[model samples]
Target: MSGIMKISDKEFYSLRSLILEHFGINIQEQKRTLLVVRLQKLLQAQGFKTFREYYNYLIRDSSPDRLHELIDSISTNFSFFFREHKHFDYLSKTVLPLLVERQKKRNSKNIRIWSAGCSTGEEPYTIVMLMLEFFGIEYAMWNAGVLATDISTRALKKAMKGIYSQDKIRHVPAGLNKKFFNKADEGKLVINETIRNNVTFRRLNLMKPTFPFKKKFHIIFCRNVMIYFNQQTRNDLIRKFHNVSKPGSFLFIGHSETLDTSRNLYKYVMPATYMRI
Candidate 1:
């Protein structure tokens, strides 16, 4: 392997601009050293001598998958099952009941949910488990499933595999854990096919100008994903989300993230929760 490829100021700026333009990720000046450290191994493996070469290669690469690889390196995928217990509580006590009532009134059993930026599938799986518990035997009658998406193909692959270390599921409720995961040979827990089948994982870049979802979602969970984006990018992405949400649908963001209620597209239902107007 080549000696650590040094990232000069100009090269760093060039790569920074590329990331901001394409991924909406604003790499602050303080993160310069972190960026270089994180990407050094990838640069060596790809045989790029400098960050400039990597930037050039990224722009010229015809296949979109290369971009996904870059994102996988830069993005953090730290998550656990039922990471935010309150959100699950609100979902079961409020959102699901409302959705069920509305769908019943419409004479439709379809329940649409989108788990945007679902890293490694924990959030979506938690959602599916709740829905199953909510409907119990009637769950089989509804066409309910989660559309889980993230930009990192690497994370999605692990999510699709439905495997996790036993400690990784420590936050999951005991009864749900017993029902949904099978104990594997080496202290690993494998999500049952039933739970895995309820979620569909996809590679989706939230920076896109327009979303191509065929139907508007009843609930959109895009937590913690916007922390990397600048204010403008977050606003723009939220607008796109608004357009793709059904009226009165719920939008769940990270507890640390807040929407500009001044936009009036959605009303504040609770902390980090909004209802589409």
Candidate 2:
């Protein structure tokens, strides 16, 4: 294994540019150390003596698996069940009710929601549970389900397994937690099959020029995902999202992230929430 490898300026720029191009993550000059810290172990384990070598190999490799591994190391997947409770509250009180009313008038029972950048399945599962709670017996009648996607295959694998330690779900309301998760040995909880089946997990890179979704979504939860992107990337990505959503659909972003409302594509509905115009 290589010991104490340092990234030269050229190497940093090369790798940083690749990451930006592929993942829309802008690694600033200040984050040079951060990039190294995140990838040092992978570099050593893979027997690369320097960042340049790793970058070269990445460019030479035709398959996407290596790039996926690189992203798994670089991307931060910090999420917990009910991480932002207010979104669920809004869904239950405002969004779902409104959607139900609209669907009722159209006589269409389809309800589409997308959890873009869903990490470790918490956000999507929470949405499923909320839908279950909201519709109760009628849930089966509506064609409602969550499309959960992330760039990290590692995270998606964990999401598909639907297992979480007790601490990860501590914030989940006791009632919902009890209803949605089954107790596993060693204090881990497995998300129930019903809730698990309601969410479809997929590995997707948000930087793709076009999303392959054939149907427009009614609600999109892209919280905390765009924080890694720069202004231009965010704009393009949000425009793509707008294009793939139904008119008057809802978009939920992270509390720390803000959108330029002046674009007129989306109107501000609430804190970190917007409506497609």
Candidate 3:
């Protein structure tokens, strides 16, 4: 009772500004109670009697680790293997063949894919599995690894482990499960080394003005992440994504999310799917 404190409007706006400015997550009025609920335990644990105290600590901490922890507390990492089945189907049936031919014409075997905001390793590992399925024996000849990144260190740590609860993987197809995952203790599934190695997990704050990649990605999967951002933030982030992807690369968003096709950065191929123009 002594430690728990209600967030005042002033404190809420101050903290919200910090989060929005640094992380690009727009904490709308509707989400204030949600944010309070999420951060209450963290504030109590840190011995902060008020949200203002917590905000002060966050601001005074110069190291990125504190910000990382804040984002970890606030960010949602709700995802499962093959969560959006159509994306995988399209990748395997349509996109991969075209990508293969394009690579061949360039005389390059490099296949770069980025699973932006890949939570808990499911999406990226699934991508690797599909690529393996698509290429089969020829997979060995192609440098077809995926760059999987997220802002939360906690999520990134779990992703790097490549282990998931069996229930979490229930959506994965039977063939892929048998091939890429091995049973773990207490009904968990650990991704096989091959599939695990095919993904490189990194901690990335998407709000950063410039991503650290030297080379542009061939396909970028940034689904469901932009829903937290406002329109301006999403537009700016999309532009940055456009700059960092190769021409004719594919962009996948959440089924419920839509890009502004008027910007001409991408052409709408289907619902939540866009191709770089």
Candidate 4:
């Protein structure tokens, strides 16, 4: 505790306001100490002596890189392959099958899925694997892939590497693991090119006023990403998602999250699952 730097209340509020305005993350008052602790090393590395100085530097920096770094420091990036199993079951049992049938009727082979806030690539990769398994030999006939976006460039870099420790992939279903991953040195599993190539990872901030996607998505997985936001931010983001989703498209959120269906953009399908109406 002797070497620890404390953030003044005013400094904490200033930093909190900036983060809320730019990233839509509402840091609670209780997290003031946590914020100081998390940012202490960053400040030392940047040679800043006080939180006020760091705040000034953050505002003066023109490039988004600093902001990104701040986000990387503050945001939690906890994820693994198939962290929640029920959603995957729903995806396999209901969503993909319906989409496939709909597309077939239209004589179209294109399938679009968006994995919003896909940290370190687990969720999106799992989706691609499921699609491949669902279509089997016919997968090659369809223009199907997943667009995985997250705010952390660091996470995206790790996702692009396509390597995971055995522990990280421990919950991956059997047989599929053998088919999609190869054993590397030091007990690591490297994702095969087939699954890795089908999932594209990009850095995107969900707080942005506009999403720059040209095509509407049939399925959007934004699980566990909105827990950091306030209710207003979450509602605004859900509206944006509804606008960009095809009618009747599936939206999968974390099991702990609930939507205010009164907005009428989406109708409840099940816990944490909604269909764009």
lDDT of 2 by residue, 126-171 (tens): 9999999999999999999999999999999999999999878988
List lDDT for all candidates, in order. 0.91, 0.93, 0.90, 0.91
Candidate 4 ranges with C-alpha deviation above 4 Å: 1-3
lDDT of 1 at 235: 96
Scored by Cα lDDT, where does model 1 land? 0.91
Answer with 2 or 4, whichever has the higher lDDT.
Answer: 2
| lDDT score for candidate 2 against the true structure | 0.93
TM-score, prediction 3: 0.97
The TM-score measured for candidate 2 stands at 0.97
In model 3, pairs of residues that clash are none
Q: Output the lDDT of residue 19, model 2.
A: 93
Best model per lDDT: 2
Candidate 4 lDDT tens digits, 11-55: 999999999998888999998878888888889989999999999
Count of backbone clashes for each model?
0, 0, 0, 0
Ranking by lDDT: 2, 1, 4, 3
Of candidates 3 and 1, the better by TM-score:
3
Candidate 1 versus the native: TM-score? Answer: 0.96
Model 1 alpha-carbon drift over 4 Å, by segment: 1-5
lDDT of 4 at 134: 92
